[model samples]
Target: MQKVEKVTDKLPELGARFTLIIFLITIIMNWADKNLFSPKLNAILEDFGFAANETTPLGIIAALFMITTGIGMVIFGVIADRGQRKWITIICSFVYSILTILTYFTPNGIAGYWYLFFMRLVGGFGLGAVVPAIFSMIGDYASPDKRASTFSKFTVATIIGQMGGLALSSGFSEWRVGYLTVGLFEFVMAVLMIFIKEPKKGVSEEELHSVLVAGAEYQFKFKKEDIKILWNNKSNKWIILNFIDTIPGSMVAFVLFKYLDDYYNIKESDVLILMGVGILGGIFGAILFGYIGDQLFKKNKNARAIIAFFCNLAPVFSYMLLFLPLFNDLYVPDGVTFGELISYPEVQFLTIIVFISLFINQGNGPNWYSSVLDVNLPEHRSTMISVASFADLLGNALGPLIGSLVYQFISGRAAMITVAIFWFANSLFWIPVIRNIKADIENNKKILELRSNQLKPPDN
Candidate 1:
């Protein structure tokens, strides 16, 4: 048995922390810009002379944005694995910002919708690269044990962006200003991206592995053949599970505002407040569950899957509260408008439930992200995540359409509850992962050892 040298030089801890912060802020800007239209959906359609009932166009545009985002992630994921992540992220961020700002320049009337649609479609391609590259960078910075917790912290930025977008769109009487604001912020962030140092791949493995096997070298470059390695891995099941799970998750993003305004009879302004509160829940959920995953993972490498299994079950029970007769009574009364019922106890109670449901709904993020990192090699991580992100985005792209079809056959309330079934099914898929997670971790360790042994000694 050969002894390994424990190198003292690691990526500076403060540098890693700063990198995460920058990535967090960048994503916040990206998501905020992308979702700026959510609260102002009706306002946007009104500008184009379409009735508020004409929501299919909105769904189509959102789906188009998501479709491009998915495709972009796959394309960029390949580049990130093989090329310079810093330049990829910088160029993409700049492009996305420029395109978003040009939303102010889209044509008017019926043509405006198509113009904005293609604008978002093109802009989403840039936005899509931001996430895959950021995740890939974080994979380099974060140790395998801390991947979920670090990723969860990063997700808090997304929740904040969601809230900020809703607030910006609804707060501005005119929706166009929201676009201007997000674009300006993104431009500032793109400039900031220029300063971020690209982290070396496999730094986490060198720094965080409990034991370094002598002569084990990490693979630095990824190849097209490695795609098969990602696909054949049993842990890739999480990729399919992400697809199943995000279908319902997308409805929460694209349909939640409409659902509250149209079905619950809540005013758009008030709905923003409710969504804001739910975002608070999401922040707490990501942090708390993320920490729990890190702790549990110290003992069980499969802990991410275990945490996800329970996280999936949680929303089922929480979302059911929305359907209870007691909960319904808390919504608008028969004679009372939402404005009048704002102070009612029942209304207040339902808002609290929304908070709980959202909290539980977000718990899946940390575990899922962490699990993906745990199973894949550093060289394959970006491509692996991008592949999963592609599936996740495709599901999200279809969510609004799926939600609409389900509503046609049932009450909107029932349709909302039915979304939980997908969550339940997503959890079931994790069961098989638990059985093989240990072996996968061990295999990864052995592969690292073999690769290290193949390297020639350094020249004096």
Candidate 2:
């Protein structure tokens, strides 16, 4: 392959910092857009003259949105691999923001339902495109050794965004205001993104650093044939297959609010507060596990997969504690403020369980992201992430649909027990990943070194 000459100067330290800030903000807004409507689903449905209990329409809408988002990720992941990622992300942000704001104008009745449904489906494209593009840039910007910690920041952002959206939409008297507000903020992020300069691919790789400093670019682009290369990689195969984890994870998440409401008689406001506490624990866990994964990764190439395996396994037990007869007697008293509710021994015990379960569960994100980046070539990173993310989307889409059926046929606890089994299965699947990661990393390094040699200028 002929070496491509570097076109722009290397990204400055200051510029890189700015870029990271913008990317984090954009991720937060994107996630908030996806989640804001969820907490207000009943309100939106009622506004369209549907019953509050009519979940079918909302379920279909959610499924379609995930389908569109997955399609967008595949399409834009290819573009992100071959084109300028910054512009792609900016355009996507703008597209989603506009659609989100337009949702405020939806009229009542069947017309309104169709409007909301189409808005979400079309809006998913923008939401999906940003992820692969941003992660691709992160792969280029973050040092290999510190990648888990860096990716953890994005994970934290996602949690905060989820919490923020739920809080805003549920707190507001009018749910449309939530969409309008988030849309305006996302638009501002798109404008701010205009200032970010795109980083050259593979700029952070140890093998290519010297060549990049000497003004050579890592110019590999994704081709249709490269799909075979992706499937051939052992680690990539495991990573993509890791979607099984998300299926039960999403099932548990989907029914959590309803379970609490039905079983514990907790109000929406109190549930939000409890969710906030759990999310805070999750944020702490991501940061802590991310740092730990990075340190362990310095010693063993398989450390991330190992950490992920245990993280997945540990959560199963905690979830059982929450769902099984262990917590059957607990109940939240009506009309108690959230602060007062936490003072109850039963509420406190349940809260602690939720916090711990979420804290451990969050460890999977950063390590999984770092492992994917480690096992792929720079040009292949976005496409690989898209494939993995689409698998995740599939699991998320199916989980709620399946969980709803299970909840109808059996008890809520039965549905949750199924979630635990799926989680255990997810943990077992990581064993193959642990076995394959070291060799994959070494193979990727060897390829980068060979490419770097070819890019080197001839000696005088």
Candidate 3:
């Protein structure tokens, strides 16, 4: 009988603790940048040419920012794959936080256009760089069964940071306060990053050679050839489409709130409340969906993709429920405005809306991210993630501009409905893609199980 080794049989729990702690620190920085712009986005729009139905350049700033982030992910994924993960996370933590806070320095108006755009773009790049590094760090050291739960813990911490930002932003009169808060959170994490240890990559028997290049000679260093191999792999095409799936959701989350503020005559203050509820919902949602995905996926490796593919239906319906204007006719009973809100009704409704939307959004994350990882070859997984991240960014950059332009041409009412239709369209895109995804995941699992016979025995 072959003596088989379990990859995680004797792993130290300390590694997991340090990884989670570092992950939380990273979330602090992420929360800071994400929230810094939150309170001020409307004010900046007002300073420019605010209107009841207007979409600000902030949408563009965010879209463009995500593009840079995608670019950073691609660049840093290659670097982290070849070099050190710890320092890469540290550098990105510093860059994203500092740049995000710098947005507050921009003078309001058209003058701030370039200023805000650059700050947002740079900050996005920093976030892009670090997220994959965090994933890589955890993946390198985590036991297979623990990966999703470990990942979820980091994601939940991120939700906590986001919740903190939303809560604080809801209180403040000035946008700078939110921006300063995110900056401080990130700056502190930057210091904590100095202590993390980079984990060594595992080399299994089937992966003794390259995942893409067959028998072609190569070292596992960053090179143009490695990227070329990544691009030529046709099996990855669906993964690229999965990235596009993220854009519509991100658009609705980041820009739709601003649209809601204007259309419903609700205060921006209440929008933060709505987002706070979203943050809370996302925290729970990450744990729930991630746990489900991990557990179901154990029995059937294709389970995650299948779940994600089906779960896409949830957002499509949620957006429709949210966008339908029949409810718009419902009147706000007197006493609710941005200020002097009677907590009785105002707080309750906003919380419901936010929690529902958060559920929709968070449900999409784990299935989508984990599905891609399940299918990819370990040697090429980092590259695949980078490409997918890039594709998602490109789609994200455009989703907002298209949504904003639709509103620009029509009213926010029309734009909301159109966004609903767009969400449905995006969900449909998954149908054809998942057929291929299921096959790949099944094949990968078969191969992994076959190789288990050759694994080294666990040291007892």
Candidate 4:
């Protein structure tokens, strides 16, 4: 490979800050767009002339959206790894933005359903690339020491985006208007991204050689075999963990509303409030646990894995508690009518448990992202994340099916217990990760060292 500048100057502070803002915007929009149709599903069905009896198309649409996005993440991850990340961000964002704007044109009746489905499938291809590209950029900007903390800070956008999506579902009068609003926000972001500059890969490596190495950079190209690196050896364990952990996690995402409605006999509107209480924990977890990971990682290289292990573990016990009468009794007062609980006059202790569990569960995310970044070279980080994302999406897609299957075979409570078991098993998968983290990080540093030295000036 031809030698290029080894380390480009870091972006101006303002530019770097704006880049993060753009990333947050893109993520928030991505999440909001995904959620746009769900809350308005009934309205959409009615508009398209689908009878109440014909509901299978809804599942088909959702499945297609997820499956296509998951596939796109892997494909675009490779391209982002090899190309200018800013360009990837711009193009992907543009595609989705345009698609969203066009949603208004979807025809009515069966044709409209297929039209929207195809549009969403294409839009997912664009939305899927946003995460890997932006995250990889964050890795380049953030030093290894601050990586987890940075990820945690950025994670707040994810929560806001997720919750914001829910709000938009009900906030708008028409689903098309909701789509247009999200699309407009996305288009503005894509335009702003035009001003951002791409960072030099591996600008944050700590080794002294990285400073000394001049005029050389790691040249990467797409290869079928490169995908193997994402799963071979050490990376495979985390990939598997993402898939396994998300299986139950998806239950929380997909089944929680219905479960709460059924268990409490509360209105769907009331459950949203409880769900919001738990989501607040995600914000707490991302910041607090992310800080812990960064601080500990400064001393112990395995801190990320350690943090992830505990975060995953704590949720297991907290989730299990939900099955007990004691858990419900804490929230449901003596002779308290369901209407009183719905009013939320007192703090819902069950929501607190959910808050704690969610806090702990979401806490693992930043550490996991940072750990993966630490173990891979800058050139490979996006691909690694994308691969993990693909697994995560796959697991989430499967999660509903698994939950439904379990619900059919056993009681709903038992099905939830199964989710807890999945979480427990998620913790178990981290053991090997703890053991291998140091070696993997070292291996990445060694590769950087080799590239750094390879471009040294020849002796005079």
Q: Count of backbone clashes for each model?
A: 5, 0, 2, 0
| Model 3 bad stretches (over 4 Å) | 1-15, 35-39, 47-56, 161-165, 203-235, 323-326, 333-357, 438-460
Q: By lDDT, highest first, what's the ranking?
A: 2, 1, 4, 3
Score candidate 3 by lDDT.
0.62
Question: 426-452, model 2: which lDDT tens digit per residue?
Answer: 888799999999999999989998998
Compared with the true structure, model 2 gives a TM-score of: 0.94
- Give the per-residue lDDT of model 1 (tens digit) for 1-460: 3222222234434465666677888878766765676777778888888877676777788888988998999899888888888889889988988888888887658999888988889998998888888888787766676778888887788788878887888898988788778888778877877776776566567432322222223446788788678767887865455577877777766667777766767777777876777789889998888888888988988887877877777777777677667755444535655467667766677788878877876767888888877788877777878888888888878877676555545656655776777767777777877777778888887887665556543443
Clashing pairs in 4: none
What is candidate 3's lDDT per residue for 144-230, written digit by digit as tens?
434566566766766676566656666677666677667767777777767655544433223321221122222345566666645
- The pairs that clash in candidate 1 are 215-452, 215-453, 216-452, 217-452, 330-346
The residue-by-residue lDDT of candidate 4 on 325-433, one tens digit each, is 6546333444655468755633365777788898988888889889888888777778878888877777766665566556545645666877987888778888899
**Which 10 successive residues of model 4 have the least lDDT summed?**
1-10
Give the runs in model 2 whose Cα sits over 4 Å from its true position: 1-9, 12-14, 324-326, 331-333, 409-411, 457-460
* Alpha-carbon local distance difference test for all models: 0.75, 0.82, 0.62, 0.74
Task: Give the Å error, residue 160, model 4.
Answer: 1.2
Clashing pairs in 3: 5-456, 32-182
Instruction: Judging by lDDT against the true structure, name the best candidate.
Output: 2
Let me know the TM-score candidate 4 reaches against the reference structure.
0.86
User: Which ranges in model 4 have alpha carbons more than 4 Å from their true place?
Assistant: 1-8, 12-14, 37-56, 104-108, 208-231, 326-347, 401-418, 456-460
